[model samples]
Each structure stands twice: as structure tokens, then as C-alpha cells.
Target: MSLGKKLKQLRKEYKYSQAVVARDIEVSQQAYSFYENDKKKPTMPVIARLARLYQIPMSELLNAEENTKEQQMEKFIEVLTRRIWAIIDLKYLNNNFFDLCLVIEEQARISLMSVQSREILEKKEFDLDYTTLGKLRGDYLEPFKEEIENKNQDTELIPNLVETIFLKEKEIASKYFE
Candidate 1:
């Protein structure tokens, strides 16, 4: 029972159309639709108005289970974003460009995989074991590392290497997003 579901249930019980409810709440019908779909959260004032309209407490309008799930998701995203930025923002690395780039690349791949939409993932037909980041890691990283090992780690090439990795990541991400 999400807030959306509760709102919808109340509307049905009262036999009111969305336009009627929107007029009562002083909002547009589109905004009311967004609330019922859980795409946007109503403000505290809007919630209080809804409570008064439905003759229910404001607390009853909020679904505790949905709030908990949303909180957990917010925390997870914060942790993931923090980890990636921490690696990318490293200022002092003991003159170790190779290790630093590798770390950043790995974290970038993890972020890419972890942040995919669950709805999109469910609709796609693909092997769960295969990921785009894993393929990119093999295609770009393995050969780069091997070349570095053979050529004795040229420091001047590190910048070009980092740029290539970033460009490849952007290209792959753009395709998916588009």
C-alpha cells in the first residue's frame, strides 16, 4: 500500500474523478496523476489537504513500507556515487597513475552495472552473467595492461590511456541511454 495506492483507493471510495480531486486539492490534473503514479511526492501542505479531504490522518496517507524501501535505495545510491567520486577525485597517489586509472576504471564499471533500471533489465533479453562493462574491461583494459607490461610502463602514455578509457565509457553509456 503505497501513498499512490491509498490515494487511488480513497478516490474510488468517494467516486470522484481525477479532475474533481485535483480541483479540490488546488492542483492540475496532470500533477494529481503524477501523485497517483508515484512519480512525484506531494508536499506536506498537499498531504494535509488530502488528509482533510479524505477524512484521514496525514500519517495514514503515507505508506511506511514504501518509505523504508525508498530510504534504503537512497542510501545505496549515495554510497555508490561517493565511492566513484572518491576514486576520481584522488589528488595524491604516490606517482602511481597506472594503479589509479585501473581503480577508477573498475569503480566506473561497477557503477554502470549497479545503476541500471530494474524495469529495463527485466524487459531486455540477454544473459544475466554478461555485462557491457565486463566486455569493455576485456576489450580495452586487458590489452592496455599487457602493452604497459611489455613496454615497461611509459609515463607519457598514461594521459592518453585515461582519455581513451573515458571516451569508450561515454560511447557505451550514450548508446544505452539514447
Candidate 2:
């Protein structure tokens, strides 16, 4: 599946026509058509607008075809779990809740890395560095620790967790590209 095919599939799934998507993203119909045809790539701003219009994460739109089936499934499960947790207001649970959340978060990361590693190996034909993956996994796992600690200690730690996650992701990405 190419990016263009993914875009077309998403558009159809969302019940959107080229003209409607173009109008929503403030691009001319021809330009949007070109994007769908893979004849031209959209600017970052246009991509952002399209992502917003489609109510999807920017990465979903940008890396749609690149993601493996396992990665996609893991992402879907994570999103669904989060939504269910939010809807049920699970945050009000006691100390045990924090522990449960921590466990879930850890499992989610392990699942994510497993999917990502499988995708890389299957599609890219390379043996990824397990040490790097382990380091990145630690980096990814730290936020859950912070979240649990914040809940337990009554401190504002979400910002720090997010920053740490971003830095770790960057580090992991650099290693992969190297």
C-alpha cells in the first residue's frame, strides 16, 4: 500500500469525496487529486490541515502505509483502551488503580515495540539493535512510572513525562536512521 492508496482508502472510509476533502483542507480539487494520485506531495501545512479535517493524528496520515499491521493493531488497541478508561472514569480508583494503570502501560509499550520490531524486520530486511530497542523501551516506559508517581505523590509530572518521551523517541529515531 502506497501513501496515495492509503489516502484514498481513508477518504473512502470517511465517506469523503475529493472535492469535499479539498474544500475542508483548503486545497484546490486538482491539487488534492494530485495528492491522491501520488503525482505530488502536499506541503506540511496541508498535511496538518488534512489530518485535522479528518480528525486523525498527523502521524496516522503521514505514515499510514509505512505502519505494519501489527503496529496498526497495537495502536488501535491502545486507543480503544484509553477511550474505554476515559469513558468509565477509571482515574478515580485508589492506589491499586495506579498499579493497574502502570501494568497496562507497560504491556502497551511491549506490544508496540514487538509490533515495530516485527515490521522493521519483515519489511526492511534488517536486524534492529536489541540494545537500542531496550534503551528506547526504557525511555518509553518512564512516562508510565512518572504518571504513577505523580498520582501517588500528588505532583504535576505530566509535562516532564511528555518531554522525556519525546527526547527518548528522538534518540531512538536517530539510532534507527544511523
Model 2 lDDT tens row, 1-178: 4566657756764678999999988999999999988898888999899888768788877886677665555453544355334422444234243444444444444433432433444454333444335545554655565454345554233345334433443443333232
What residue runs in model 2 are displaced by over 4 Å at the alpha carbon?
A: 74-178
When superposed on Cα atoms, how far off is each prediction in RMSD? 14.4, 9.7
Q: How far out, in Å, is residue 51 in model 1? A: 0.2
Query: Which regions of candidate 1 are displaced past 4 Å?
Result: 64-178
Cα lDDT over the full model 1: 0.59
lDDT per residue as tens, model 1, 1-178: 4677667756864679999999999999999999988899999999989999988778767653354434434433443456544653453133344665556556554544443433444555223423445655556655455544443444455455555655555554443232
Steric clashes per prediction: 0, 0
TM-score for each predicted model, relative to the true structure: 0.37, 0.41
Query: Each candidate: what lDDT?
Result: 0.59, 0.56
| Candidate 1 TM-score, true structure as reference | 0.37
Using TM-score as the measure, the top candidate is 2
